[model samples]
Target: MAKKKSNVVNLDERKEAKAKASSGNSMMVSIMNMTKRIEELKTEKQKICEMAARTILKALDAKDKYTYGHSMRVTYFSMVLGKELGLNDQEMYDLQLSALFHDIGKIGTPDAVLNKPTRLSDEEFKIMKKHPTESYEILKGFSVFEKVARFAKHHHERYDGRGYPDGLKGEQIPLYSRIILIADTFDAMTSTRVYRKGLPYQTAYDELNEFSGSQFDPELVVKFIRGMKKEQAKKEDKFYIPLMDEMYEKDAA
Candidate 1:
């Protein structure tokens, strides 16, 4: 009878151990499933954010075709400098956003000032100069655009503390902002506008050299010029913007 009891006890112990093992396996599966779901949620959120971003960009495009195209070129030029500076993936991404939206405030600009074929009056210029601050206001409203907004706001800031909206001087300006200003001026110089013919790339380079250390950071100016030369050597007449997923002509059309 004692031997019989021992055999029964061993069988019950085995059953208990098997049940515990099965429960542990079930718990592990549940955890993995939860983790996967969380990752999927994150991807979905990112897609939604991108969709919203594209929508805002389309609105900007509808507001001003010239500014839209100018922004694209600026993005390309900024990326050239960014690559030359060896920015990591995250920095490059942020730089691209900053450059692309640097002039987004122009969406609020009146057609009279934005598309005028003549030089702006001081009053009109004042209205025009409000763009950088306006850009900050628009972009800062989006959670993903924090750095982008700040950089755009400060892009017009001069190294000598003479820029409008803000007097941030030298390195007080975000590095990305400093880079965007160079690209912005470069595009403005190279793009043919209704007001006047575009300057030659060589002439633009000379102009940039003339203002270095006053309007631009001297070191960044050198990097931008060097990067642009390499870009020209590639002999490609078009550049790509990852956000728009589009290629644009190097020269103004």
Candidate 2:
């Protein structure tokens, strides 16, 4: 009887050991599967981000000829202004992104109105005002562009609340939007359109100052103008006419 009991006990011990070994293997397999899934998710996330950015750029390029590549240039200029204005990294990033999509709503505007050789008519002007709302609606699905969409919605909002869409006057409008507003306007003024020649830098600068009180945030306009002057001082040898010509050509095409 004692010998039989010992044999049974040994058998039970073997079973327990086997069970533990099996559990360990299962745990390892589970961990490996989880790790692989995480990697796959990361790859998919990156792909989606790339796709979204590309879609935005393509949409902008198709919106208008002159405005084609202007988003990125405005983004670069806004980043410079954001940095000079003491914005943090995240704030600067937001400004850059907002500037990139500031006119994304123009995607919904008719090409006739967008590319017209003459100024927009009152009826056309009314259509133009819908861009902010249209952009907001179009971008609502994208988490990446949510803040940028908000900025886009309000980029034209005047400091005094006269601007369209939300009309969120002054500080009520996001600071990032404010920065983009100045940057976008500056770039537009300096770049020619179908109906008009580009304003000279000095003339554009003066116009900015002239509109500071009503059209722009007074403090931000100062910062933007200062940054422009500093950039000009650094690139004094470059005529910039070629750059302007290329920019307008890209848009006109």
For TM-score, the strongest prediction is: 1
Model 1, residue pairs in steric clash? none
Candidate 2 backbone overlaps, count: 2
Which tens-of-lDDT digit does each residue in 1-253 have in candidate 2? 9999999999999999999999999999999999999999876874585467658657668666566566766766786688679888667666766776677778778889887887789999999889878777766667666777788788788888898877788899888878888888887877766567777878988998999978899998888878877877775432221112322222211
The true-structure Cα RMSD of candidate 2 reads 6.3
Model 1 regions lying over 4 Å from their true place: 1-43
- Show the lowest summed lDDT stretch of 10 residues, model 2: 239-248
The local distance difference test score of model 1 is 0.90
**Backbone clashes, each candidate:** 0, 2
lDDT of 1 by residue, 17-83 (tens): 9999999999999999999999898768756766776677678889788888898899999999999
lDDT of 2 at 15: 100
